[model samples]
Target: MSLLAVSNLAKRYRRGGKPFAAVDDISFEIGPAETLALAGPSGSGKSTIAKLVLRLIEPDAGRIDFEGGDFLALSGAALRTRRARLQMVFQDPLAAFNPRATVARVLDDPLRIYNIASRAERPRRIAALLERVGLDTSLAARAIHEISGGQRQRVAIARAIATRPSLIVLDEAVSALDVSVRGQILELLLDLQRQERIAYLFISHDLGVIRAVAHRVVILDAGRIAESGDARAVIADPQSAVGKALVAATPKLVRTSQDAS
Candidate 1:
């Protein structure tokens, strides 16, 4: 069974006193240890779908099932409890964290909030989380402001996995980083999925990143599904106008492991 299943999800919003659909009748699923990419232009409903699945915003219609449970129907403590298994990494990693907080403190908050470890054991857990993200524990003493953009993103990723979530919603997680750092982050994500067997719903406008990481691809355009299939097949032979345009517009250079450093 799919780890997450979303069906007929819809959301509407008021703009200039007129109602418009931001996400309309969109549906998709993520399998165990799978990466599904939601790609589209700036205004397409990509992020809206992410928020809807995460329950950050309530959908106007449809159902969200995670591991056979009704995610949309959950509320209060139940919702909070379910969130422990669902985590997110945002587009801007630095913006996701408090500037004044040290790396240790940032990682500690989720552990404490989830009660993943005892007060005395959190320090060790923090160090381990940092290590898994390719960061050394010494950097734990540094504040978010003191770290490089790449390191800040690493901390963001570390925090997401702290609770050992079943799935992660990475909303343009590597977009802000330059080409090199972006490559490393993608590799790190792939490695983490192998190690932890966690599923990912990767949201991005960059086709290159999606091609590199996603097993399946779902192209969204104007608040709807434009095309979806195996990542390689969709990229090679785009069926939709938006998909064709995206593939044509994408630069030919495929990022490599050497570019990571």
Candidate 2:
């Protein structure tokens, strides 16, 4: 069974006193432990779709079924409980987290809010979360702003996994990092998915990154799906105008050793 199923999803917005579709009739499915990437140029509705799936914003039309339930129909306590199985990692950790908050505090919120651990056990849980993300436990004492960009992103990831989510919506999560760090983070994500059977709704414009981590790719253009297929196949021989343009614009298509295997 599909872990996440989005069917005929649409979101509209007012622009210059006229209504426009930001996400129009989009549909897709993600299986357990699979990586499905949404790749498109700016303003192509990738981030908007991510927000809609996470319920950060409501969609105007269509259905979202997650784990065999109507995700859009969930509310109140049920919604909150269901949210524990879904998480997000944004493009910028500095903007996503409180700069003044310590790493331990950031990781502790999920455990406390979900009642996953008692207060006395939270510090140990936070340390374990840090270790899980390839960070030193001592780093937990540092403030978010005090850590390097890469470290802050790692902390963001650790926090996301604290609740043992089945799905993670990553909107340009690795775009802000340098090449070497980007590869490391991608490797970490692949490792986590392999270990925990987590699925990812990866949103990004970088085709190379998508090729490295995504089993399937959906290319969007102006809020509509232009093409969808196996990541390597579609990228190697783009069939749509937008897809061809995107591949042409990219000077290099570097494939990581990971290669979605």
Q: Work out the TM-score per prediction.
A: 0.96, 0.96
Tell me the tens digit of each residue's lDDT in model 2 across 149-255: 99999999999999999999999999999998998999999999999999999999899899999999999999999999999999999999999999999876477
**Candidate 2's TM-score:** 0.96
The lDDT of model 2 is: 0.95
How accurate locally, in lDDT, is each candidate?
A: 0.93, 0.95
**Per-residue accuracy of model 1 over 1-261 as CA lDDT, tens digit each:** 999999999999999999999999998989999999999998799999999999989999999999889998899998888999999999887788889999999999999988899999999999999999999999999999999999999999999999999999999999999889998999999999999999999999999889889999999998999999999899989999999999999977667655742
Give each model's clash number.
0, 0
The RMSD (Cα, Å) of candidate 2 is 2.9
Give the local distance difference test score of model 1.
0.93
Candidate 2 stretches greater than 4 Å from native: 253-261
